[model samples]
Target: MSSTQSTAQIAGSGEGGKAFPIPQGMSLSYWLQGVRASPLLDHRTTEQLSKSAEVVIIGSGMTGTLTAYELLTRPNPPKSIVILEAREMCSGATGRNAGHCKPDQYRGFAKYSELFGADQAKKVLEHQFKTWTRVVDYVRKENVACDLWVGDTLDVAMSKEVASQLAAVYNDYKAYGGKVDHINYISDSAEAEKVSRLKGAQALWAWKASTLYPWKLVAHLMKACLAKGLNLHTWTPVTSVSASPSIPAFWDVITPRGTISTPTVVYATNAYTSSVLPSFAKYIQPTAHMCDKVVPPRAYAGSRALQNSYNVRMPGGTSYSINPRSNTDGIILFGGNNPNQALLKAYLDADPNRLFDDSLSNFKPITDAVRDLTSTAFEGWSDDAPAAGIGPEYSWSGILGQSADALPFVGKVPDHPGQWICAGFHGHGMVHIFNCAPGLVTLIQGGTWADTGLPECLELTPERLAKINERANNVGKRVV
Candidate 1:
């Protein structure tokens, strides 16, 4: 497809609001700036679908590409592998995120500990950090040109209540024997503000993190996989999959073009996984998140640029994930949801169909709220509007898969011996997929979850699925 046609298709995909018309000149993401012009942007190995493959993977985002990379690099690789994508390469959440690879060193420890005990909770955090480091090491070893940068990430608490809560969580984490050597906490408001470079900061927790151009990294991986005899078919949405009646032990992956029979099938579709696999309909929900790119004025540019990425916590559960791109002229990638009850209600009550559909339209209320929040929340943010205007230069929403149990479901699909799944990252795919993908490849190669070396909780066993179903059902009832 031509650039104009591609943009138009994406615009109609509902990355913006569907009920409202998209504002004129409202760009999606700065990451997609020169993507259409790149040769790897919409690559397809064959216009016609392959009749059969040894393994068939759905979705061409980071998870699918990485899974393919792992499978192809194995000692005894699959003879034939095919990747099917609904949209352009890496055009999903992987390409639309705010470029943060931060691990939850302590913030989520309390909650995870409460749910799964201290040991499992610590393993979760450890896995996240391991994934971050692995990605950094992979980038270096492969010489991937994705502008990857490792640095500290600030978790700034803007209110006294939040600060106190953070302190309590930190205490709990430490009490549970979670690692704290890498984390530096600042409690005094004065020092917090100075350290975070944000006004009204009551506390700050700094830890190791990294940022990168996600699309570029995934593209490089896709290129490597393609060179290793992987068949990539873009713009081909898999409508359904079923056991092949004629071919015993083989499954048929049905797409718009044709069906590809394979013995093994992996669903890396994430948010859209439920659409194809009805079993995950209740387990994995699609949640929309907004993100934007901002061109900083004189105050935030040049030497004054932010050195660390941030997760600024405001009052009433409001928070923003920020990443400053020095290579892109100090452009700040900012993203979050409004904490207001009304906005949350609107999103929660929105039609599931409209929410899952990918289309771009004007979301003025959200856009205005985010702009106001960013303008007032930051310490030295000036009212001076750059060429792009007072608000973000580009703003758009992307769907993320939220699991019912607040954890990803990785490994084989239950009851389907050859079918497998590696999705439901719950908005933390970048920190989880790198580790999850290799582990999934291990399972696909007849290795046990223990061999993959991932945490046991991540395994998609029958018990886990039953537990999720029980919780979901009980949520509708109450004790009176």
Candidate 2:
């Protein structure tokens, strides 16, 4: 389990309400030194276009920023380009991610390969590999310091059932000519401890995983796009799009601030896509994405600490990741729909923190539960200080679209020509978008979706849109 804090009790970022307790050994100098850097994306008055551009993109996060950069720097650039954001650039999911910019080495392509086909799986793999390399290269070349890190991730299995399940899938990945070099399934508690630093654990290690500070990275990219002369605006929420066969080459996009007429439009609003279109609403579902930051004791951040990312399969149906930031201190960022379901009910009920008080009591049992389950294997781990207790520094939620068949619904909106979309990345936007955005740009400019090089499954279809709408409508308790 986990702690349940009432919305009121959950730590807020203000003065004299409830002081945040700074952890022991946490000096002002150290805190200042540890703060990550982000790129500049000015959030001020909304920008007005002297004239509508040839192409207008919505959202200013990675997806939109990356695509804008590609378009402006292409062999033949668009006549004019504009990026409209509802808030500061990178303020959405792009800034809120764990900043782990690694390929999809852990989420085995076996199941996806089986369901889609070997060729499609290979394409997905290629897309992620290229994206990973591009991100690292951009960060390095631009001299962006967002705590870029490179390390393998351990998918720890606490039970035989999980071990068996992973073993079979690991072999399947190998059979499909995929990368499995760093994956090590360990049954010995001693061996697992060496890699995970968590006692009483068994795990499968995926070697190519990495992490970074997401907000800073996105901000840097946004800044670079501006340096390239692309027009960008903030706090401009698009209300709707009027595109029909009669106006195939143009769309009248309405916003709270004003209206813009553009020949082409691209959407980078992943979770909030449905908010603009009633049909899209049935596709993307907004759910609570919860994670907590903690200052583990110095011993935990030392050389003997958990070397890489750790995803633990513990009691109940919950999955947790033990991630070590550059410094010794680490944070636990993991969850699935299962645990969230129970937490959501309790959270919706009358002030669970006052009633059940699980946040530090029953709910937060997992904090110590993992240690007790392993007998100090995660030794040195301690409860968060009042300053950075279980509460997130900036916790918020965004919607992500899910295809009925569990693939991305990319490309043009059928029946609405000249209007393109690049949302619905499931939960793997980092892995999917770096290349997907560039490819979509090409398709939008050249007027051929075939040039995207993605599988047909990723393309929009009537059946896919129907299912997307169905899921978008029934997203109640299951979402959180």
Candidate 3:
């Protein structure tokens, strides 16, 4: 079948059994609606696919596009680079995420300290903070029109229990000699409520962070890569990848179009990594997450708008990340997973690949809970009918690659010499991918791990894999 015919069939194929279909009710983000529909270099390539390239990068999201950009910009670039996308460019999690680039200032530090050591935990924080800065610098230097905004992000604790836990985590981070200059703590409940504007806020932690149009950034990078001779194929999904039968030391990338034989294959597939690399099936499990855009009333518009982004933490471990869009009439983008049992069970039990198959049936309970939460949870939100008819305008779900150990797997695939991986972001790709992509490029060029300068915890080694599996097994036993 021709590529066009194959793509048509794939689009019509309902759920397509394990193949990752873009979730139903997948509303386009405020960012994606602005970009042109056509991909940068997709149409220029021929339909026939039995091609050969020096490097074949799978998935054209941020990681894949950034990796290609780095490779093409480096001195003595690779002879051939091909990027294949399962759907439209940047339509996956990258396009669907909340667009906040805030790093975990203290919460993750405490967790990482428990998982690894204090030293490694500190490195993780430093790595994330540095990556945030790198993204800021890159966007400014490149003049990318991604509506990048640098501002403070508030982590507001609405309950005493959460407040105490955050205080303990903050103490733990500082006790380990972690940097605290950039973080501001608000322990006074009154002060937190005043600053965060959240009713019943018990405490808050504030730090410098950013928000941006992620789809725009990825599209800009892909365009630059295309200008520098990067071949891109969209609407092309890889069925499987295996060792080349004819060529030694090469792998055959099987797609509906055909096969691409290359010595090096980079899996930037993130949540879909398990579909391509079965070895990581258990390690990098796909979890579905939902986000929505809320059109606020006049109370949140223009000069009365919220000045900073937020991670609002309520009681019962419920939290939501919010970003205010000034250009969109002060509309707020809210995203989070409801802590309710039904919602959690639905998310945990559903197949990541088919979560989008029938979003209404699969996610109605969660989305309804989200709407109710938004209407009642916030400090100034009103559930009563609004004069402006303002409320949640759109709701959508996307898949997040949650690793067993809560850390991304970056570097060479274990036991697979010619294959490399840059997946498993644990739903925090924005803060991690910027630096990780560059580091992965260094590895692809045969550089040492030390040379990449990434956190040691992120290295994808056999030892780390075994430890993650053991941890998962132990947790499973406890649950049983």
List of clashing residue pairs for candidate 3: 23-356, 24-356
Q: Decide which is better by lDDT, 2 or 3.
A: 3
Prediction 3 global C-alpha lDDT: 0.78
Write out the backbone clash pairs for model 1.
13-358, 13-359, 14-358, 14-359, 14-360, 15-359, 16-360, 16-361
Rank list by TM-score: 1, 3, 2
The CA root-mean-square deviation of candidate 3, after full C-alpha superposition on the true structure, stands at: 4.5
Q: For candidate 3, report its TM-score.
A: 0.91
lDDT agreement with native, every candidate: 0.78, 0.59, 0.78
Residue-pair clashes per candidate: 8, 19, 2
**Alpha carbon lDDT at 33, candidate 2:** 23
Q: Across residues 8-78, which tens digit of lDDT does each residue of candidate 1 receive?
A: 12221222223221111222556776476876666789878899999999988899999999999989999
Off by over 4 Å in 3: 1-27, 36-38, 41-44, 327-329, 340-344, 347-364, 369-374, 377-379, 383-385, 477-480
lDDT of 2 by residue, 17-124 (tens): 222211111111112223334224455323464346778888887788888888888888877778887655565666645455657663546656755677677667
Candidate 1, residue 288: the lDDT equals 62
After best superposition, candidate 2 residue 216: deviation in angstroms? 2.0
Candidate 2 regions off by >4 Å?
1-51, 244-248, 315-317, 327-341, 345-377, 382-403, 447-450, 463-480
Work out the TM-score per prediction.
0.91, 0.77, 0.91
Give per-residue CA lDDT, model 3, range 325-355, as digits (tens).
6544466887765555346456546544443
Q: Best candidate, TM-score-wise?
A: 1
